[model samples]
Each structure stands twice: as structure tokens, then as C-alpha cells.
Target: MVWKIYMHMTSMLCLGVAAFFFGGLSLVSMSTGKCSLIEWELSSLNSLTVVFVLIFDWISMLFLSFVLLISSSVLYYSGSYMKGDKNFNRFMYLVLLFVFSMGMVILSPNLISILLGWDGLGLVSYALVIFYQNEKSANAGMLTVLSNRVGDVAILLSIGLMMSLGSWNFIFYLQDMVDEKWLLVKFLVMVSAMTKSAQIPFSAWLPAAMAAPTPVSALVHSSTLVTAGVYLMIRFSSALEGSKIQSMLLIISCLTMFMAGLGANFEYDLKKIIALSTLSQLGVMLSILSLGYPDLSFMHLLSHALFKALLFMCAGVVIHSVKGYQDIRYMGCLVEFMPLTVAYMTLSNLSLCGFPFLAGFYSKDTILEVAFMSMINFMSLILYIMATGLTVMYTMRLIFYSLSGNCNLTTLSNIADEDKIMSDSMSLLGLGAVFMGSVLSWLLFPECYMICMSMFMKNMVLMISFLGALIGYMLNMLSVSSKLSSLLYYKEVVMFGSMWFMPFLSTKNISEAYLVWGATNEVLNDKGWFEHLGSQGLYYTFSKIFMILSSLQMNSIKVFMKTFVVMLVVILLFFS
Candidate 1:
């Protein structure tokens, strides 16, 4: 019956609408401070008390609005994109599940609720990633789920640690914890946030996540899942107000920014490049949030959602038109065939690159200025500079590769314009990217900027970063024999060598050798030690051991059965 109901369009639409209304009402009630209609108070649960205030923040309301809007857009777009697919009903169900889960995540008032939402989103995303049921998709889904689980465990630890410190409520605990204890909590939170946000070591999973459909990628990268990390940071920024955690966060953010930027430079896949660029921009926002400017972070988050969605959607259009080729290296001279798409893509990329007057410029400039003003340590300054430089490098590379590079005539011949639905969606998102900055001007700059200088002086560090990007772009375009071309081919090698190999080398030989042996044995031995441990089959061995020790219990069962049979026979004989 449930499956039958889900198969119908009307039913799916109703479910989506219901979820939207419920989420909206939750936000509205929180804003108005009314008793929630969906309330389920758990006074017995001490941890519930810690996160209660999370339900009522104005920022949460704003996040809910975006969640509903983007989710609705994806649903609308999917209706057409997925019209005749065999698994249309299944796809719709997953979409509904995704939206519902994100709604819960955004509206969750406590840690337990947040974890529930987080797990739900992660599960739905994994399912969606493997929707096609292909080998590559399945592998991608597994990687995504594993990485998310790692982050989820870290979050659980952070919550547990906070609770152990005698403060479970975020507001109370954050407000009441001693400086030292709070710092420790902040560290745990940062680790969790890093994994969720795909910073540095965890960043590789995001590119792999591009295995999902374009719409899923847009939803994940642009609006919801990735932003959860930033949301966490913003929600707890007050607690992290005056700690070294902020400085450490800034450094992590910068490293992610630099690595993603450099990685994107060598990427040829249009979608993968966009994914890396998303990571890079997210790093910028995290850095700003680290500087204790939630407003700036919020502004960038909004602008990034608009423009990055537009950019990804445009890439989707190109891929759809070309029958699934996403390599920008082979795609060229699309301006003639896809003039409107080119226009939209160009505008969105401009916003991404922080060109003047676009949404990105205002938000990014604000962050740069804040970082400059709030420099508490040398690490912060270095991080700020590196972040700025990387931002410029990758954003420009995305623009050049997609819109300006030399066209491969053969690839161009095979390509055509996308469907009207795809084009229209991209155009709409592009327009949003163009206009969102001016819509929220107050959040962009502090009043001090207006008073201190007659003209807004963009940070010199940012300027230098921009110059570095321009130079990199020029070098890429003008080099007759490409030095960077080889570097691009081996970019993954660099990333793996730096992020994985170096760390592996730093570990003690025993640990490193164990890892090496496990990798080899995992394939060589179908039932390897690590595999057995991973499966928790140690319990099975213990069960066998228990069976041997408790052989008397087995005899007891036989005796009891025999005694019951004898008693039944005696009763029968007496009756006879």
C-alpha cells in the first residue's frame, strides 16, 4: 500500500508539499515563540535540554527557507528530467526522503535530533549516489557513506565530551563552560566540522560524490549537506569566541582552500572542476567564519549557494546536451551552439571568481577585510593569504576551462544545446547569483569600512591573490609547451602524496606496515584479519566459545524435553 501510494505523482507531490509546510511551520513557530505542533518533549533525556534553543534561531529560519526553495526547485526539475526513467518512482521517493531529512537537520533543536537528521541525509545521499546501480556509482556511494560516518562519529564524541563536562545544552554549555573545557569542546567540534565539510583529508570524497545525478550534486554541493559544516560553525561561533580553536580552524580552512584550488587547476572534468571549486569557496567561507564574523560567513554562504548551483546546473546542461561527456578539455567553442547557456555560465563564473559587482565580490571582499582586521596570530595571516591566493587561482581556472579555452572541433560537432528545462533552470539560478549581493548589502561590510576610507579598499592580500590567479590563467593560455599540463595529469598523485602518503610516512613503521599489509591481504585473503575485525566477527568466535563452556545447558534442554514427554505419557496412562 505504501509503495502503491508512492508510485503516483499526486501522492509524491502531496508528500513534498506536506514536508515543505511542516518545515516552514516549524521555522515560523520558532520565530514567533509558539509551542511547536510537532513537539515531543523528552524530559527524561538530559541531552535534549542542551540543544533546545537551536530550534528558535532566526538563522535557522533563513536556512529552512533556502532548504525548502532549493528542494522544491530540484523536485520540479526532476519531474521533467526523470520523466521516463524506469526508476522514476524510486527516484522521487529518494528525493522526498532527501528533502525531508534535510528539513529535519536544519530544524533539529537538539544534538540527538541533529544526529538523526544527519544520518538520514547521509543515507539518502548514499542511495542517490548509487541510483544507477553501476559499479562506479556503488563504489562512490560506499566512499561517501564511510567518510560521512567518520564525521558522524566525531560529532557524537564532541557531544559526549560536552555532556561529560556537565553542560549538554549548547547554549548553557557554551555559556557556562570554563575557558579550558570550552576550548577542548571547540577542538572536537572543529574535527567533526572538517570531516562533514570535506576539508583537506576528507575533501576527496566530494569529487567522487559527483557520481550522482546533476541535481543531487547541486543539492549536496550547493545548498544543504556541505553547508551543514558551516552551519555548525556558525551555530557555535559564540562558544568559540575567544579561543585558539578559531586560529586552528582558519589554518585548516586555508589548507583546504589551497589544495582544492590547485586540484581544480589540473582537473579536466567539468563537474569535478566545479566540485573542487565548491570546496575551495567553502574553505573561504569557513575561514571567514573562523574570523568570528558569522554575518560575513552567512553572506558568502548565500551567494555561493546561488552561483555554485547555477554553475553546476550549467555543467549539467552541457553534459546532458553532449550525452554525458564532462571533460572540458574536449569541449570548446560552445558560444555558437549554446549562446544562452554560455551567457549564463559566464555570468555565474564571474560571480564565482569574485568579479566586481557580482554577488561573490561583495561577500568575498568582506571576508578578506575581516581576516585582515582580526589577525591574532602569524598562522592566521598566512592562512588568509593562502586562502585568498587559492580562491583566485581556482575560480579563474573554472571560468577559462569552461567558457574561454580552445574548442575541440570534433567535440563541438558532437555537442548541441540542452533542453529548455535545463537552460531555464540554469538561467534562473544565474540571475539569482547576479542579484543576491545587492539584496543583502548590510551584511557585506562593517560601518567602519565606510568611515575609515572614502573608498572601499579591498584587502591587499586579496589583490595579490587575484593577481596570482590572473598570472596563472595567462600562463595556462600562453604556454606553447605546457609544463603545467604534466602537472595537471599528475595532480592526483600530488594530492595523494601530500595528504595520504606523507601522513602514512609520518606514522610509526609498525602502523604503516600494518596498513600496507591490510591493503594487500584484503585482496589476497578473502577472510583477512582486518576484514574479520571490520565485520565484528570476533563476537561470533566468542559465541562459539560460550557454546563449548555452556554444553551443560544443551544437555539441560534435552533433559527438560524428555521429562515433559514422560509427564505427558504418565498423565495419559492415568487417564486410561
Candidate 2:
């Protein structure tokens, strides 16, 4: 046990050091407005060359630094969270592999190199998701992997399509290939990004992936796997600007934001609620990216990562204290027992809601303001407001249910914020959640955005947030004896609460339909046409012919004797 703790400390120290190194480099690159690309020629044949490209732009460097930082913290937290588990070492190894894969994705600019990292992430995520080795984990792993496989295939197709250009370095060629001739490659890249980021039809897997351990949840949802898609999209934003695909992306991201926010509000599972919030924030990043603001999206991505990871850590602490129970309905007035954790949770949750000057506010508020200033359609603008409100609503509901309400757990429940290792890990992120927004705002935006909106339009963001908070708190403030109001709108609750039946659509419905189709296929082909035209038919036909020959041989003895006699007589006549 001592050795395991040492291992965790050693890994944390190494990663923390590396994070600082890259962070300084990122700052240098950003300030100098310079980037470095190193290429190693792996092979060259027939005018096609495979190059392993490492890009050291401020974007890659900054993202890499954040990923390493979060990874180091998660490892330290896991040392406490996964204590006494027999497979603790194995879990640590998987996490390291996951971090390595994310680093590959961050540093590679070549499509082929990126695919290698992309696929590594998918494979490692599957391994980590099913780490518990249970039926639910198994199922969730399957859904997660299969959902990501769609994106994997998209990346593979993009690689194939890029072959015509003789080089896989898309960054150098995206602008030149912006015509319809290369539109499909850009579209495929976007689709792959969507799946990784869990947008729309692909959103089911993100919630299902909550079957993973909480440490993995924090890492996956925050800096590593899911954000890979947004990062990839940011890299490709130049090609996507002003295209019809961007418009479509805008619509899909808005729907995803609204859907995830609504679903989070209705969610009971604490982990699932946070997972859906991640989905909603991913939509925020992608939507801004689609609006031709990749830098803003990238800024939101970074700020969101800090608070989201911190939020998941708090969730982990709570789940650990409650002996693995996750239903928020069974948790109340936790602040009484775990004040420090609740404090961190509140900070992260407020940041998630874009509360003033918090980490989320700097990026998220800027996105809203810039989006409002942009010339978008009526529907998009309405969804922007609605999704924003829903974000605050769900956050408030979570806070009220888990922090201020009457106690729901047993009177003797032992819950406290005494885990030093876990607390230390969360401390750094808590600081980030409080201050990373303003820091990133200053760094990412050299010149501030000029706002000329009317007082009403300017205050609309505050108004919606306040309204959402009021509704969320008021709706959940019910006595134990009171009838549930949600029961009155059963259908609406069911629809919205279940992510509009996305899990059903992605898993159960699709599996059932395929099973029925397989049965029909068996009856029509494997057991029907192939039965008559394939091996069975040939066997029966050949058997019948052999039976006829056997009967002829058995029944034709007289004819055989007559033929022999005739031949003998003819021979005798010829001799004479």
C-alpha cells in the first residue's frame, strides 16, 4: 500500500512537471505568435509520403498542458478513491494509457497520426468504461465503443479521401481544398467530431458511460476523450467557416444543448446529471465553433474543463461517502456533514451556470454575448436563451436537492470531507474553477469585445439565469407528504427526462430492429434460397441421381447377360 501511494505520487510529480513545461511553451508560442512543426519521414513511395507530424502551436501546447494537469490531479485522486481495490495498479495503468492517447491526439496535425490517437482513445475508453467488469459496465462499454466507432470510421474515410492529395497534413491544405471537391472530407471530419463530443443522436453514450469509475469520469468528461472532438473541430474550423455544414452544425449543437440541459433537470442520478451537463457544455463549445469563433470555443473548452473536472471530483467524493449510492433523491442537506465538499461542488456548479466572474462566466458569457451580436436566425437565438436558462435551472435544482434540503440519508450516515489526498487534488481545480475564466479571458482575447446592445438585451442573460434559478428552487421545495407535481405531466417528464428516448433509440430499439431483421434474413436467404441452391440442394440432387444408378444396376442383370452373349457370339464368328 505504501508502494502504491509512492507510485501515485511519482506519477503525479512527473505529470505536474511536464504540465508546467508545456504551459510555459504555450505561453511563449502565444506571445510570439509562432508555431513549430516537426516532421519525421516514416516512408515515401510512389509520390505518396507518410509523415509523423508533431505540431507545437499554442493551441496544441495549451491543450496538452491542461490534459496533463488534469490527468495528474485525477491520478492523485484515484489513489484515494480506488484504495484497497485489488486491481488498483491496473486501473492506474489504464489511466496513464488514456492520458498518453490524448496527448497523441493533441500533438498530431497529420490525419493519419490523428487517427492513430483517435483510435487509441476509443479502445482505451472501452477498456476503462468496463473496468468494473459488470453487466452494466459491459453494456455501457459496448454502447460507448460502438458510438465512437462511427466517428472512427469517419476519420478512416477522411484519411482515405485525403490520399488523393498525396499528403495527410490537412492543416496545410484545408483552405486550398475548400471547394465542393473536398467538402465530403470536411463533412466526415465534422461527423467524427460530433460523435466523439456526443452531439444529438450520439449523445446516449455519454450518460451510459457513467458506469465508469468516477475518476475516469472526471478525466474523460473534462480534458481527455470527449473534448478530443471539440479540439479536432477547432483545428478544422478554418475549412468549415462559411460552409452549409457550419449552419447545420449550429442547429444540431443548439438542439443538443437544449436536450442535454432539459434531460439534466429531470435526471435523478448524480453522475448522470453531471454527464449530461458535460454534454450541454460540449454543445456550447461546438455551437460557437460553428459560428466561426473557434478561439472562443477553445476558450470555453478550457474553462469548462477546469470546473467540470472539479465538479466530477466533488461528485466522486459524495458517492464515495454515501457508500456508492448515486440517486440525488436519497441525498439531502449534505452541506451539514460535508461542508468543504459542498463548497467545492457549489463553486463548480455555479461556474457551470456561468455565474459572474467564475471560470465558466469568462468563456460562456463571452460566447453568449458574441453569439447574440452575430446575425443568427430566430430559432437559434431562442434556443441559445432557452438552453442557457435550462443550464442554470438544472444547476439550481442540483444544489437545492443535494445541499439545502432536509436530510434524506440515514441519521447515522458517516459523511465527511477528511480525505486529504482527494481534497488536495480538488484544491487545484477549485482554484481554477474560481479564477481560470478571467485568466483565460485575458489571454485568449487581447482586445475586448465591444457591446452596444440596449439595456434590456444586455440584461437578458442575467434575467434568464435568475428566472431559471427561481423556478428550479421553487419546484423542488416540497414537503415529504406532498404529491409529486411531475406526475401530472407524466408524458412530458418521461420524454424529456429520458433524453427524448435517445438511449432507447441508440441501443434497445436499434438492437431489436436488427434482431428482427436477422430473423427475416435467415428465413429468406440462409434457410430459403441458399437451402435450395446451395449445399443442401446439391446433396439431395446428387443423392437422387446415385439412387437411380443403383436401382438400374440392381434391376438390369438380364440386359447385361444378353449384351455379353451377343459379344461372345460375334467374336466366335470373327474367329471362324
lDDT of model 2, residue 566: 89
For candidate 1, lDDT tens digit of each residue in 396-489? Answer: 6666655667765463355555466566556556767888787656533435343132233444755676686887688667642365565564
lDDT values for all models: 0.70, 0.92
- Candidate 1: pairs in clash: 50-168, 50-169, 50-170, 332-407
Model 2: per-residue lDDT, tens digit, 1-576?
A: 997899789889999999999999999999999999999999999999999999999999999999999999999999999997899999999999999999999999999899889999999999999999999999999999999999999999999999998999989987976677788998899899999999998999999999999999999999889999999999888888668889999999999999999999899999999999999999999999999999999999999999999999999999888878899878889998999999999999999998999999988888998899898889999999999999999998898878778788866568999899999999999999998889888898889888777788788999999999998888778524478878899999999999999998999989889899999999999999999999999999999999977765885887678778989999999999
Every model's Cα RMSD, please?
Answer: 8.2, 6.3
Clashing pairs in 2: none
TM-score of every model? 0.78, 0.90
